[model samples]
Each structure stands twice: as structure tokens, then as C-alpha cells.
Target: MTRIPHETSGEPNPLRALGLDTLRRRTSMKWRTYPEDVLPLWVAEMDVPLAEPVVRAVTDALALGDTGYPAGTAYAEALADFAGKRWGWAGLAVERTAIVPDVMLGAVEMIKLVTGPGDAVVVNTPVYPPFFEFVTHMDRQVAQAPLGPDLRIDPGTLEESFRRAVADGRRAAFLLCSPHNPTGTVHTAEELSTVARLAERYGVRVVADEIHAPLVLDGADFVPYLSVPGGESGLSLMSASKAWNLAGLKAALAIAGPAAGADLARLPEEVSHGPSHLGVIAHSAALRDGNAWLDALLAGLDDNRSLLSDLLAEYLPGIVHRPGEATYLAWLDCRALGLGDDPAQVFLHRGRVALNSGLPFGTGGAGHVRLNLATAPEVLTEAVRRMAAVLE
Candidate 1:
């Protein structure tokens, strides 16, 4: 990891001197109405403005009054180009790519399509709650594979779990989160390869959620699952929504490889005749031209992440983190703090900060909370200060 240069004296972070301060100043004027003096560090959204490309795309779409369904070939070329430039892998075969409303919808659809009722779907515990929600909601049996202390999938244990499920005739699919949410640990290419092997061995399909791929900070590279060796056999779901703050627009691209691709390729022919015109346009612009703004945004996030790490080390010692590799979400172990009951509630009602309780993340997430550091450094600093005051 590269260390950012700090000033010799009371070094001021460049992000603070940049647009972050301005953003906070405007947000503070109406923040109280939303959370009442509390920082909203719960959701996976940045407080920064959108990239110019994204803005221009949306604006142009509105200007042209092109509200109809998008043509198939338009965003396909953009996605293919983005994938090639970003990951150095290509041959996306746009014919197999389908636009979905969002990641959650894609996940649900994949689960239903891959497995049937009574079959088991494997997912690591302390994951993005929706992983569990999708399986259970579909009335399918869920196989919980808890992540180990490093907050990563334990291969040995995972292998055993898969064996048990297969023995029971319940094994069918695995729901995987890459650059995993909450914890923010980007899985190594080797790690993804192992997962592919597991899927091959157990005859289970893998559903990789890579929604947070673009949020990787400070020159950190994001690896697409399909880019990994033998990844062409797995399913990769990706989008520009998370990092580009296009969630409201509701668009995600699902790439199907030989193993899972063959199954998903029928999506366009079977359902949702075409992609959303607005989503396609916005996604195309962001991927094709958003690099400059993305670089600056990542720099700002790095500063905020560094400030939070320093503050946690100094003021809230003993709380542990896994060293975030991607995304603004920070998974913190607050068991040492011993804030009774849901820590999120305690912070909101008392500390006046809103954080996502770790409980929903699964077993290991019990004593933790997910913090979103996408806001300005000033807001995060104030939130930490208030938290310290409560604990002190």
C-alpha cells in the first residue's frame, strides 16, 4: 500500500481544502431535518457530487427527450470498452449482456434461476444482509458459511460446508460478494480462483456481486471475477451505480460466462425486452468518460479514510478494521466499546450518529457496525468526536 504524504506540521488534508468543505457547508444547512444532528454513515452513498460525465449524460438524455427503451448496441460497446480498459480482459460478447434494474433484482433472479426450493444456497455470514434476504425470501434453504477472523471466506471450512450440503443433496449455488461489502476487503485474484474451483468441484454456480468495484481507492485495482483464470465459467454482476451514485437511476449489467452465462443469456429474450434508456445512457457516459472525476473522488475518499483510521487509532483504540481496499464502507469491531443493544440505535439516540448495526452482517458481525466514510472529512471528524464524547 502506498502512503499518502502528510505535511510536516499540522498537515491539512487536500480533500478538506477542496470540494469536501464546500459540500459539508451546504449539507449541514438541512442535515438536521434528516437525522437531527446525526451523521448518516449508514447507507452506501457518497456525499460528493456526481462526475461530470454522469451529469452530462443525464442532462443530454433529458435534452433529447429520449425516454424510450434503449437500443441494444449503444451501452454494450461502452461496457465492453470499460471492461477491457479497466481489467485488461475483453471479449464481453454484448449479445449475452442484459441490463437489470439493480443488483438485488439480479441476485434474486439468479437464485431463482439456478436453484429450486429445498436446494441449498451458500453465502458467507456477516455479508450484506440482502444475501440472506434473497435466499430466504425465495423459500430456498440457505447454507450459511461464516467468514473467518480475517473477514474472508475460510476455504477449508467452506469446503467442509460444501461437502456437507452436497451430501445432503442440498447444494446448488453460492452467492459471493467481491470487494465484499461492509468489510471492504477486495479478494485477491487467487481467492476468486479458489472460489471458481470450489464451484467446479461442487457443481454449484457462483453469483458474484461486484457493485462496489469502481469504488476502489488510490490506484487499487478491481478484478472482475470473469477476468480471473476460469472466471469465464462463472456469473459476474456489475454496475456503475454504487461509486457513481447512480442508484436512483436503477441500472446494472449482468455478464454471463460459460458456466452461468449460458443460463443468464436468455434474460433479454425471455424477459425485460430491453435495458432502460436512461440507465444505458448514464452508464455509457460514466464508463467512457468519468475517469478524471473518478480519480479525484477516489483521492477525496482516501483522505477521509485515512482521517478516520487515525481518529480510530487515537481516540477509539482497540476497535479493529481489516484495512479497506475498496468502497467507503468501514467494518469496525466495537465489541470493546460495549455499547448495549443495537449500537446503531445507541449512537443515533445518544451519540447522535446513524451507523448500520453489524448484526445483519451475520454471526461474526455481532459486535461490529458498518460506517460509511463517503461524506466530507469534517462531517466524519465531527461524528467521531461525538462518538468519543459519548464513550468517554
Candidate 2:
């Protein structure tokens, strides 16, 4: 298995710097001291190599020399199998699934399908940046329901937005992320039901992004929004990108239930057609056979996260890590540490670790920084060491 060099270290192992190599290679710098020795804890891509099954699948596809349009039922069948075996919310068939280029495309298309320009698209702030653009770029209005301090949705605020939109008689839609980005909140089943009921009652189409659903960490179960009662009426988008580190492959499935599913399937033929041949192949391999490798990767991530938590406690004790139930990203509240202005910038310039500025995740994310812990321990440890040195 061709893996990053840092991934193979032994016990007393230095933290494996997953993206550091790529960062170093791109910046033309060396480890731990190049102009402040920047450690990149941003970007969600894993430093580890592809799972063996994924590699084999891609290799076989390449060997066949068939890099044509990925029009087929296999990818959809694979997705259906994954949804059933993993989440237990059925009612999905291959015909109801369309192979899209990526989650973003599916999302933008869903919003466009459900609403027109000047209509409203509601999103929880501090969301994936693209959600903002997906709505605004289309000349639609964006309703930001910022999360409260607990890092969960402020249902009160969201309800207010819905009421306002309905009162104005404007069409509305919702763009939701499960195992949400940056914040790493795995929304509870009951919460999802509530959200669904809101959408149904308000006549808003819900576009649920479950791209990170496969990587629920810390013993939490990954609940598909559609699996909850009344959830099938919403649109669900999933991908192999996060779990298998296959974002470059660009394959994702958009499933609509008998209710929303039919509307989704009836989307423009341009969007409903097949996916990338490579993406389809990679996704199929990931869903059908990447469980063992995923387990190992999760174990590695769990260990890395534990190390991060312990170090933050011991060194940067002032920083708060909103408990991570899913996703490799950690939302660090650096406000308590008194890092002036933007902690992300302070960490980048002083601590030499590049983290996602919290402001982008939404209102409550301000003064927070998101760190990607999907790398090797040696790398993460070194990053923490640098961060601790700057603050300690």
C-alpha cells in the first residue's frame, strides 16, 4: 500500500504530518522551521493513501481503459447497498439515484430545482462556504440561522426565518449538512425529525448533505436524515469523498424518496445523467468493500483526536474543543486563550499552524478555529507543540 512516508512510524511515534508534505512540497519549505514552520491542519483530505479496495477498483478501471461517461446502474446499486447496510433507511432504488459530479453540484441543482431567483434558501451559518454561494450566486436570498453557543442549530432562530419567509409568501428551501462541517456536530435523530417537520409544514424542500455521514467518530451512530420518520420527503445527498478521501474522484449520489425522490429524479436530464467513470468506480468500491480499511483509518483518527484533546488540556488549556461526534475536523474556541483578533491568523503567523478561521462556519464560529485531525499523530503532535509554544 503506497502511503505517505510519515504514516509508517513505530511506537513513541512522532505525530504523522499528513498534509504537511503536500504543504511543504507546495510551499518549497522544510519541516518544523521553514519561515515559522507552518503546519497545515486545514483541508479535509487525509494524509493516508486510498483503501486497498478503492485502489484496486480504480486500477482495474484504468486497466480496462474505459474512462468514458459513468452511465450505469452499478454505482446506484452500490449506493443503495451502502444506505441499507449502514443506515437501515431503505426505499431507495437505482433508478431513483443519479450520479452527480460532486455534492456541491447536487446542492446547487436542488436549490435551483426547488426555488427560483429572489426566493429564499435557508442555511445554518458557519456552514460549508459553498452553501452561501450556492444560494447567493443564483440570485436567491440567503437566510442565515446562526448556531447558538452549544454548536447546534438554534431552532428558534430557524423557525423565525421560516415564518418570515412564509409571511412574505416567498418560496423557500433548506440546505442542511449532516455530521456538519467544521463544527462536527452529528445532529440527533429527533433533531432531524424536527427539522423535517419544519420543512414539510413550511413547504420548503430540504436538501440534506450527508457527505460526511460515513465518518461518525467517537462511538456515535451516523443517522441518515431520510431514515428518520418523515425524512424521506427530503432530498439526501451522499458521497464517498470524505470517508475514502476520494474528493478528487468526484462521485456522489443524490437520492430522493417516493416524495422528494420523484421530484429529484425528474431533475433536468443534464443533471440527472451519469457520473465520472472513475468516480462511479471509486464510489462503488468504497461502499461495497472499504469497511475494514475505513475501520483502521477511523482508529487512527480516533487516536489522533485523543492526542489532540490531551495536549490541548495540558498545554493550551484555555482553548475549548467542542466535542467532536463526527468528522475529523475539530472546532477550537481560541477566544478563551486571548489570542487577539483572529486566532486562526495568530496561529498561522505565530504558532505556524494553518487552521480554518472560525468566522466562515457561521455566527457562533467567530473566535474559533477548525483543525483537521485526519493526519498522522507525529504531525498533529508537532502542530500542537508549536501552538502550545506560542501560547504557553
Candidate 3:
């Protein structure tokens, strides 16, 4: 096992420290989904070691034979403390938060709280793929409100979508992805306030998926939706999974705004049964004691983001990539490569580089691909080189 440095000690970049040989040996979807010859950079999983605190907490619990159903509000409290110290927002009320299986499950429950089967759920297009899948699977219609040219929420477009969504007195819900996936646009407090106002005016409920909140890189600030004025009726789901690389540990919190407390209360009690007790312990430990490790990870990611930009400019000059303010995912515009609608397929077959096809991200996603950036710098450089070779 590689010796991961302690938080207090200055350590090398985590993303670069993990060797490719070690990574390929793992059996996660990111590594096993493709052939050995292909370079996989499509999923949200990071190729780094778990934070020391998280590992210690989980192992301690296992040693004591303490695996049982999750209980208590420790997870919520830990998150509340982290949010206050990190984002300077004290709006997280532990009393109004509930434990759920994961971010997507929490989102499904939040959407169900204020909406009924067959109602409309509005989403920003070229957004997360699961936003469409999970909502549709729940028997709700998905309305597209594609992002503006700058990839930020367009109020005019959003308002229009909201109007159409609630037509005929139908109750609608807006599913917001904060520090949004793929594109990684961090929503400002001002932008969230506007969304709250629009949702209020159009009578649409807002359910924010803030799973990537803790992963916001430099030059960006994450605004909790519930902290904004007029956002009292909104709901947000957050977790330490993304930041601590704890996705396999299924746990998340669904927090309701002051005005939506009643709706959140109506969530079925059985929903809490989905998360693993060990997952709760790991997530709680991450929120409370993983800050030092998280800080180190963020610094490494910032460097990777810059390195990716430079690599793209030199190898794939025609590809347009607006460096995102958050998340380890990079959305690349491959239209200029003349690879047609789904360029990812071309890269996979010709370059042996696996990337997420943009088509599933909904409208405005074509001629694009999403690449994961949470890997060793050498792996990222080689992936870009392989992709560029396809065009040659």
C-alpha cells in the first residue's frame, strides 16, 4: 500500500501520486467497464486513496461489530458544521434534514414531496444524465431549459420553461445541479436568488442537487440554495461522497428550507432505511475530520484543471473547453473535430480512449464529450494524446 501523507504534513498531489498500474488493478466501474487497452476517463470516481479519517472511522466501527441500521443525527450535524465553517452559511437546520441513500435517491424523494406522478420536472440541458433517467423512471415528465451561450442559467429561458411546465395548473419542480456536473458552472448567490424568485413566481418547487458543492475549485463560491432569500421553500441534497471519494458508501442528506418543512416531513420513513450504517459513519467522519485531506485534494485538482487546458491547446487545438469553476469533469466541445454528433464514440474506437458521450446529457449535448479529470497528470496527458491521434 502507498503511504498517504497526513493532513498536517505537506504532501504531493494526490491525483498525480496514484500510479496507473495501481489504478488499473481495481474493479470499479471506471476501471472495469472498458478493455485494458482503453484509457477510461468518463466516470465521476476519483483515482485517489480515501482520506485517513474516513478509513479510520469505518475500520473502527467494523472492528467493534457495530454494523447495524443507521441512527442519530451525527451525519447531519457534521455536515452543518462543515457548511458553516466552509461556506459561512448557518442555514442548515439539523432538525429539518433527513438521511437518504444517496444524492440521486434524495433528489427523487425531494421531487416526490412536492410533485405527483406525471407532473413536469424542469432541468438545465446538457446537464447530468441521471437527472433525466431518474425523473422519467418516477413517472414524471422532464422539461428542458437549456443553459445560455455562456453555460449559465438564462432567466428568460428558465422563466419560459417554468411557465410552460406549470401550464394547466400543473405543479412543477425545478431540479437544480449546483456546481453543476459536466460543465461545472458554480451558481452564484445572485443566480440562486433569481432562481428562487422565478420558482416562487411560477409556483414551481426547487430541489437542488448540491452533491458537488464541496468540490468547488478556486475562483468560485458555492451558494446554498436554501440560504438565499425566497429560497425558504426549496430543498437541497448534499453529501461528502464526491469530495472524499466515498461514492461506494451510499449516504446523503436531504435538507428542507423553512417553508418546505411540512413537505419534507411527509417523506416516507422507510426512505431512511436505504443508507448503510457504515456509510453514515464514513460520510460523517469525512465531513468532520477530512477537511485537511480535502484541502490537499482541491489544490491538486486546481493544478490538473490548468494542466488539462494546456494539454488541450497543444494537442486538440480545435476543441473548445471553457475551464469549469468546479468538479473534476470537463465538458469538451468536439464539434470542431468534425466527428459528428457523438464524438466520444469516435475517440473510443479510433483512439482507445473512453469518454462520456454527450447525447445522453440532453439537448445541446451533441458534438461534445465529458472527460474525468481526477486522475494522475500523466494519465490525463496520455488520454489527450490518444484522443488527438484519432483526428490525425
TM-score leader: 3
Q: Using Cα atoms with residue i matched to residue i, what is each candidate's TM-score against the true structure? A: 0.89, 0.90, 0.97
- Candidate 1, superposed: residue stretches over 4 Å from native: 1-34, 268-275
For model 2, residues 1-392, the per-residue Cα lDDT tens digits are: 11111122222211243355454544221233335456667877666767778999999989999788877688778777776766665566676677787888888877777888899888887788778766788898888887777878877888887777666888898888898887889898888888888888888878898899888874576777777777777787888898888877888888876677667756788774545788889989988888767766766777877889998998888998866788888988888878864788888888888888877666676788889888777778888888888876
For all candidates in order, the CA lDDT equals 0.75, 0.77, 0.92
Models ranked on lDDT: 3, 2, 1
Error of 1 at 249 (Å): 0.4
Candidate 2 positional error at 304, Å: 1.6
Model 1 TM-score relative to the real fold: 0.89
Model 2, stretches more than 4 Å misplaced? 1-36, 272-274
List model 3 lDDT by residue over 38-104, tens digit each.
9999989998999889999999999999899999999999999988888887889999999999999
The total of clashing pairs for model 1 equals 4
Give stretches of model 3 more than 4 Å off: 1-9
| Residue-level lDDT tens digits of model 1 in 135-228 | 8888877788888888888998777767766786665878888888878888887888888788779878788898888777655567778767
The per-residue C-alpha lDDT of model 1 at residue 184 equals 86
lDDT of 1 at 58: 86
